[model samples]
Target: MKLAVVGGGSTYTPELIDGFARLRDELPLSEIALVDPDERRLGLLAGMATRMLARAGHPARVTTATRAEEGVEGAGAVLLQLRVGGQAARDVDETLPLECGCVGQETTGAGGLAKALRTVPLVLDIAETVRRLAPDAWIVDFTNPVGIVTKALLDAGHRAIGLCNVAIGFQRRFAAALGVAPERVSLGHVGLNHLTWERAVYLDGEDVLPGVLADHAEEIAADLSMPGWLLRRLGSVPSYYLRYFYLHDAVVEEQRTKPSRAAEVAAMESALLEMYGDPSVDTKPELLEKRGGAFYSEAAVALVASLVGDRGDVQVVNARNGGTLPFLDDDAVIEVPARVDARGATPLPVDPVEPLYRGLIAHVSAYESLALDAAIQGGEERVRDALLAHPLIGQAGPADELARRLVDANRSFLPWAVSR
Candidate 1:
């Protein structure tokens, strides 16, 4: 089978290519089309991918294409991993929100809305191309603001599944702490992308979450930057991104004192690219671990394998709500454990959520709906309204200011804003 990676130039591609090689048995790929607009970066990554695959004795042909149309053609799966305005734009997204006294994040607050506005339209356009070139292909989105992007694709009637590494990362971590193989761990992970919680951890069909917390609360809390008491009190582990909500003011203070994550990632990308160009580097570098997206390759490969091979196995993925959560609309995209097969991902049944978690999830889900509307039908008011709805930017004053700054800073990316 053939697979196409839309943002093949990204530093994350090598890690993905490594997974394609290591897990060749799980998902046998005959060809990989690396699609990117930057020919220089594309060439560097293609060479790296070819070498890595060859070293693994996998006979997959690596091809390069500058156009999404050309790259996705005849592929069984199209992986969308592109960044619309690149890290330069992400730097602005991360910093611009701090001006409004909000958390400066790329995927959850005012910054996340800015990214959604710029990304959703572009992703939809690509989905259109995928429809024309590879109609039956499953579009596995690993893009930021995945919940919003996946909603757009599903809204446009595309066969798509949103994939994130958060669930897989948690599974791997929990398995290590419990001294079990990664596959032996299953998470009762639920909520939106980047905004999820590990409600339960099952090993051999038994929930050992209480034992995990009892034994490893301090270490787990340290990783999430949350107090161990909070995990114990809630009887669940919140994703690290929840820190933005749980300790908003504290996080803002810390963000102000440090360089934006975009800056760090930018520098890391430079070093990673330099390493990618070296012929001797046939394997993924250790530095890639610090670059984040931990275990992304495993997650992506497994999801694609399940989808292509008609393996009706359960995996955590972002899929339509379909009444899985009684409060959310059927069309709302939710991140949860789902059964995957050739038909697509179907969210598994979830137990009733506590009011504490449900309230926050509902609030964010509402904001996401408005954000999607603003992304699809661009206007200053829609942007302002979406910002106002966000729990991080609930006040109208900052919301209005953020709306103006977001549009102005991202005018080049938002065509409607550009025309205005």
Candidate 2:
């Protein structure tokens, strides 16, 4: 099968390439088109991918294309992982919100909305081109703000599914704790992307989440940076991103002292790229682990196998609501477990949601809808409205201030941000 990775220049690509090599039997990758506009990083990543495949005796041919159209044409699946404004832009996204007394996060709050605004249009354009070049090809989005971007593609009538490593990360952690294989663990992972909760963890088809929580509350709470008492109260584990909301002021204060995550990632990427250019480095380096996106390759490979090879497996992915949550619009995209195959991902039924989580989901889903509107339609009014709806910026004064700051900081990337 032919696969195209839209952000093939990324340091994350090698992890993905390693999975392709190790799991060659699952999906017979014939040729891989590494797509990116940045030729330097693309050249380095392609060289490493070729080496990794060769060491595994996998006969997949690795190719490079600077344009999405050139790379994705005739491919069976195209994976979107591009960063619109790169890490420098991410620095702005990660830093500016703190000045407004909000969490400066790249995937939630004002920063996430900025990312969505910059990303949705670009992803929609690529989805449009893919529809023209390879209409049947599945668009697997591994981009940030996956919920919004996936919604954009789905709204435009493109076949797409959003992928995040959060569920897989939780599954792996739970599996280790249970002394079981990762496949044996299933998560009742529900909510929008980056904004999800682990309501249950099933092993041997029985809910083990309560025990895991009871036994590992401190460890889990430490990882989530949430107090153990809250986890106990909720009877669920929120994704780490929830830290921005549950502890908003503290998070803002913490963010003030640390270097922006973007800066740290930028340094890591420089080192990884240097390593990628070395001929002797045939295997993924240990330093890649520090670069984050844990278990990304495993998750991406499995999703690709299900989509291209028709495995019909249950996986956590972002797809249309389709009444999975009655409160959400049928067309709204949600992150949940779905049975995926060539036919497309079908969201499974969720158990009755508690009012606590449901209320937040509805609020954010509404913010996301407005965020999507501001992203696609583009206006100061839409931008302002989206910010007002965000749980992190519920007040008009702060919302208006953050909106102006967001537009000012991101003017170069957003056409409308600069147009006005």
Clashes of each: 0, 0
lDDT of 2 at 397: 89
lDDT of 1 by residue, 114-195 (tens): 9999999989998999999998899999998999999989999999999999899899899999999987889989899988
Best-fitting candidate, scored by lDDT: 1
lDDT, residue 102, candidate 2: 80
Candidate 2 on 1-420: residue-level lDDT in tens? Answer: 899999999999999999999998887889999999999999999999999999999999999999988999998899999898899989998998888788888889899999999999899989889999998899999999999999888888998999999999999999998899988999999999988999999997999999999999889999888999989988999999988888888888899999999999999999999999999999999999998888988898899889887888899999999999998899988999999988889999999888888999999999999999999888878899999999998989889998888888888888776766
Candidate 2, pairs of clashing residues: none
TM-score of every candidate: 0.99, 0.98
Question: Relative to the unseen true structure, what is the C-alpha lDDT of residue 334 in candidate 1, on a scale of 0 to 100?
Answer: 98
RMSD of each: 0.7, 1.0
Model 1 scores a TM of 0.99
Q: Considering only N, C-alpha and C atoms within 3 Å, which residue pairs clash in candidate 1?
A: none
